[model samples]
Target: MEASKVIHAIYNDDDVLMHAVKKVKAAKHHIEEIYTPFPVHGLDKAMGLAPTRLAICAFMYGCVGLTVAILMMNFIMIEDWPQDIGGKPSFSYLENMPAFVPIMFELTVFFAAHLMVITFYLRSKMWPFKKAENPDPRTTDDHFLMEIPVHGNQQELHDLLAQTGAVEINVVDKAH
Candidate 1:
């Protein structure tokens, strides 16, 4: 977590930022990261990131949750220890299935919520005891940041950023 070299262009205009990103990308320079105060539509494509797989992951996770809910409720209410306090039959799944819905729904929600949280935590590398990694505070408020690594033509990259109407530019040495 020490020092590494990073060059960032700070922009106040989202339009300018968008145009700038497109220009640099079209020129075939890879953009390392983009930080905006608010979401910008189509920025992901401009940054050359493929569409996210989170939706598919969510669907799969939800299915697992629902399946577990159904199985658990079936085992507990119908199979292991059946009781007939209300004189309702528990011998048939289809007969008592409607009544078992509430617990099934509850468990479904519980599992989905828990598993999604775990997935998010693991995917984002976030842990309760882990230290946070954040950029400058100003970038979160009024400014947007576009970080480009210094591979080659560092000066030309800075110049290109300035030409794109960046209000401020900074070269950071974040090497460890």
Candidate 2:
């Protein structure tokens, strides 16, 4: 793989980072990546990234969980062992659905939360013992870092980043 130079611009505040992102986009510069200590609202939109489909996935997972819960409850309460609980031997899932509603709801939330996390981890290419990709450790605490590829316009890009209120800027060779 060929090594290419990239510019790393560090910012202290998220507002400044957002403003710099907008300015960089307005100038037609492509932002490779941005690392922030916390979630910055509207940063994805400003970076022109596509909206995530995690919500849709979560909904589907929830549906699956609800179906499983319904089937399991029906089999257990109605078909497998029709018990005379509270002297009500209905043997019908519909009749006993009210009692199963809580289980269904809990399973739905559990599946959505757990599956969504696994899907996110897989989709993000994260795995056990995976090497960290963070360029700056400070970004994990308070600062924000923006990465832009340098294409023979290092001086121009450096000056532009500096004008956008970057506290520190560095040119580093990155391998792809």
TM-score of each: 0.87, 0.96
| Model 2 pairs in collision | none
lDDT of each: 0.83, 0.95
The candidate maximizing lDDT is: 2
lDDT of 1 by residue, 1-176 (tens): 66667888999989999999998887788888888889999899878898887767777777887898888867887898777859896786788887878877777677777887888899989989998555667777888899888776789889889899999989887554
Give the root-mean-square deviation of each candidate in angstroms.
Answer: 2.2, 1.0
lDDT by residue for model 2 (1-176), tens = 99999999999999999999999999999999999989999999999999999999999999999999999998888999899989888579998888889999999999999999999999999999999999999999999999999989999999999999999999999999
Against the true structure, candidate 2 reaches a TM-score of: 0.96
Q: Give the TM-score of candidate 1.
A: 0.87
